[model samples]
Target: DQQVKQNSPSLSVQEGRISILNCDYTNSMFDYFLWYKKYPAEGPTFLISISSIKDKNEDGRFTVFLNKSAKHLSLHIVPSQPGDSAVYFCAARTFSGGGADGLTFGKGTHLIIQP
Candidate 1:
């Protein structure tokens, strides 16, 4: 079964507005979550991330919030611009003793920015 899920396959937002993408996970072992943005023919680039210990993390126009109790996380982009349009993937990883575990990714959500 898919451990991470992005219920909405696509989201459309107006320029200069706020765009919120939601993600849910079934794996309770996940302690770190990351969001990546991908454009056509381009590799996914890391955007924002949040640790399970923190409720929110913000960087410039991007903000990520994690709710460990609910196994939910969200990425918010304020003043959405045309460049913000892309496929966003939510990934989660469980930290082991030392080595890093592979990340579980959700089916990406496409964000469309409209003028």
Candidate 2:
């Protein structure tokens, strides 16, 4: 069974607007989560992240929020720009090992920013 899921296959937002992406996980073992943004023919790059202990984390225009009790997390981008149009993947992992083997990623959600 897929432990992490992004229910929405795609999301469209107007430029200069706010974009919100949602993710859900069923595994309680997951203690840390990350959001990765990927462009066409390019590898995913780390965008924002939030730990289970914190409810929110922000980095400039990108912000991530976690609700441990609900096993849910969201990424918000304010003033969405044309360059922000890409596929966003939600990944989760336990704080066990330092390797990437423990990471679980959701089927990315494509965000389309229209100008």
Candidate 3:
């Protein structure tokens, strides 16, 4: 089974603090990992990603780390802001799958940036 799991359903943090979200996977074939941020009534926007070959990646205030040996990954948001208060979804995918390949998303973690 190709299952991506986000253990925490939500996380709360003070503004300007670091917010860390964790995710795990059961399938080793997943090559592409992505994180999406969503606001109310709007579609999720791609925040960052890392290929399976890489161990760590970062973008400005966002960072993603992948550990293939453990089948675990995490997203870190530094100096969390009020605008960053939204749901975050972690996803993984592969192109070589038998069917039309697409993203597999976790339920999402509701990040609360306390202002």
Off by over 4 Å in 3: 97-100
Compared to the true structure, candidate 1 yields what TM-score?
0.98
How would you encode candidate 3's per-residue C-alpha lDDT over 24-72 as one tens digit per residue? 9998889999999999999999999999999999999999999999999
Weakest 10 consecutive residues, lDDT, candidate 1?
94-103
Candidate 3, residue 77: lDDT: 94
**After superposition, which runs of candidate 1 have C-alpha atoms over 4 Å from their true positions?**
none
lDDT of prediction 3: 0.94
Every model: Cα RMSD to truth: 0.7, 1.4, 1.9
Clashes of each: 0, 0, 0
Number of the top lDDT candidate: 1
TM-score of 2: 0.95
- In candidate 1, what are the lDDT values of residues 22-108, reduced to their tens digit? 999999989999999999999999998898989999999999999888889999999899999999999999889988898899999
**Clashes by residue pair, model 2:** none
TM-score of each: 0.98, 0.95, 0.94
Which has the higher TM-score value, candidate number 1 or candidate number 2? 1
- Give the poorly placed runs of model 2, Cα more than 4 Å off: 97-101
